[model samples]
Target: MKSTMLSMLVTLLLIYLSVCLVVFLLQRKLLYFPTPPLLHFSPPMEATKVSFENGGERLSGWVVNEGRAKALLYYGGNAENIEYNITFFKDNLPDYTIYLIAYRGYGDSTGEPTEAHLYSDALHIFDQVTAEHSQLSLLGRSLGSGVATYVATHREVDKLVLVTPFDSTANVARSVYWMFPVSLLITDKYESAKRAPNIVAKTTIIYAENDNVIPRESTERLIEAFSHRLENSILIRSADHNDISEFPEYAVRLKRALN
Candidate 1:
């Protein structure tokens, strides 16, 4: 009977080890999906290549609508390409010159992507754009919203728009992965909540009413965090995680914020 009990214990230990190994391999897919690929320049828009020198690594992006009335710098979500977003700007917000910054490892940009690297790349783009355009606005969606918030905290700008923004990456992870220790495991913190209070610019945070990916409760925490820290701010209605920009209210809110 003792030998049988010992065998059962060994069997349970092996099963536990096997599960751990599988989780270790699949964790990356759960953490970071839709990795960037090779560049495919758009055929329609007039794209100008802008290269920023970052510690011997060259980060590249495209400036769409180079010479326009105003300039808007957009830092996109995790699974985005400059070529795809060019149409959104050209079709909807053509009044402003658009800079489509491809995060490192996304689009034509070379080098591995990390939270710190992407934030610094955005600052470099902002410096170059501010040199030319008198009126400048910053926009970010999803993951890029975190990057945008960082920029808004540091710089003086006309308007700042964060679409489907989150309070912090750790907050979201806690909501989704309550059973796991994702908050500790996640490498990219993207702690927008800690930085939102520092934004002095006119800010508009557009939260989706039906955003499944980012819990509405956490978004409320973000809004409250903003109100407690920042002075001028507004929240838009009927915006979702991906389709908030489609609503006409979004454009109206943007115009109001900028003006």
Candidate 2:
């Protein structure tokens, strides 16, 4: 009987150690992700480097126009360099001045990426853009939606747009890992659904009908949170998470959102 009890105790210890290892691995992933180099592309807009308040980091982006115009600041997804988005911005709206922020650790920028640092970087970029241009229109896609939402709530802006956004990282965690307690584990809480309505600017929430990563249903929940404050909202048919800009409807909806 004593031997049997000893064997069971050993098995339980092994299982606990395995679970702890898994959690440790996931925590590291939650903190830092690899950022690939910016792909070379022909931008219809003029490219420039903007310095950040943080002495070490600088942002490289495309400036659409030199003249005074409505400024559009774009924040991109986790893995993408905002430089890749220049063609979409130039083709869709040439009249406006667009600043596509290439976040630190991505697109030829210096320094490692972290949740708090990135959020602070967004504010610094917004302050610079707002100083340069009077009318500021903020746009965010996927991971950027969290950054944009945070900015909109804190700062004054003319327009706000969120593309392929989820309700919150906590909810997304629940969906992806229902068996595990991810809310307690996740460090970066990109809670767009909870924060969007606090924004007083004219807002538009666009979701792709075919988005697999952030499902259409989650965006609907996001809309419900912002329904009272949002100026306009729409769903682009046949648009997937990564390829929403490929659809003509995206441009149309965005143009309308600007107005």
Candidate 3:
């Protein structure tokens, strides 16, 4: 009976290890959820479609209200159709030109999506736009917050805004799967908290009052990490993680933050 029990325990251990390996291998597949590209917009907002080569990969996005001295670079969420923001940008931020990048694999961009490539493409876009705009700001929401945080650490952004942001992808994953060794088994760990200290840009972090996606603790930890340069942190009352952008208070608070 003792030997049988020992064998059962060993079998369970092997099964657990196998599950961990599988999670490690396919972590990115679970993390990034790319939606189909929206090719057309109704009542078009007079934005121009643009494309550039980043490491030979064609990255595509929309550029709205070009020729403004002040500019905003927007990094969108996972599964987000970035083109949906065209009208919002046109109406709310008329003074600044906005560049909304569709992540590789999410839109017309031709490349697989990963943290390394996303950060690289962001840097490329930043460099390309810097010469044209005198003052450039950054806005990142959800998964894009990771990419945006990485860019803010490396580049010279005037203002940085993170919406529904997490302290780190690994931390969030670990919280979600406490029984598993997520930290050891995950790739593309967007450790935003680790990079927050180096960011010199005036920063604003926006959170939902009832965010069901990213845990409030993760967001609070990220806020604490930015104790040095965080200009403001706002929570949109009565908003959830996905619907926060639809609220009037969100835009109002965002505009205030940028100003």
Candidate 4:
């Protein structure tokens, strides 16, 4: 009886270890869900295709209303098709040129996605647009918020808007997978809270009142990290993680912040 009990315990231990190993090895695949190149709403005739080389990788995206002195650079969610935003920007923010960035592995951009690569690409995009535009604002949603926060800390941004933001991806993962040590296992720790203090740009965070992905506590923690900058954070009362953009109030608040 004692020997059978010992064998059972040993088997369970090995199974747990194997599970942890798999999770650690394929973590990025779980974190980043890159959508296939978008077919619908390809860059409209009014927009220009912008492509640049970063570390030998070709990155591309659409630049709408390209000649304006004021611009908005957008970094989208993990699986977002950024081209969908062109019509929204064309109709509402006609005054400023908008650059919807296609993160590596998403859309036509070459190479795979990683936190370091995303940050590098974002900086390159910002620098390329800076020559044409006098003032630049940043908008990042979900996973892009981490990339946007990193850029805002390093660059001179006029305004910073984060949608469905989190304090840190590690913390968010830990909350979801409480049995594992996700903080230690996560390679792309987009710790936005850590970089918040370095950002001096006028910042606004938009969160869904009923967010089912990122916990309200996580969003609140990110808001707190901004300290005095918390004055501008807005919550869409009837929205969820992915559908916040559908709300009229969300667009109205975004226009107010960007303008």
Which regions in candidate 4 have their CA more than 4 angstroms from the true location?
A: 1-3, 40-42
Write candidate 4's Cα lDDT for 54-124 as tens digits.
Answer: 98888888888878999999999878988888888888889989998688888889999999999999998
TM-score, every prediction: 0.80, 0.88, 0.97, 0.96
Clashes of 4: 0
Q: Tens digits of per-residue lDDT for model 2 on 128-166?
A: 768777798889888888888998888888999998888
Model 4 lDDT, residue 148, Cα = 91
Q: Please give the range of 10 consecutive residues that has the lowest summed lDDT in model 1.
A: 228-237
Candidate 1 ranges with C-alpha deviation above 4 Å? 1-29, 34-41, 228-239
lDDT of 1 by residue, 113-191 (tens): 7778888888877886687888888988888888898888788777888878888887887887675566656667788
Best by TM-score: 3
Worst 10 residues of 2 by lDDT: 44-53
lDDT tens string, model 3, 79-162?
898988999989899889999878889888988999899999999999998999999999999998999999998888999999
lDDT of each: 0.74, 0.77, 0.91, 0.90
Error of 4 at 190 (Å): 0.4
User: Which residue pairs show collisions in model 1?
Assistant: 208-239
Candidate with the larger lDDT of 1 and 4: 4
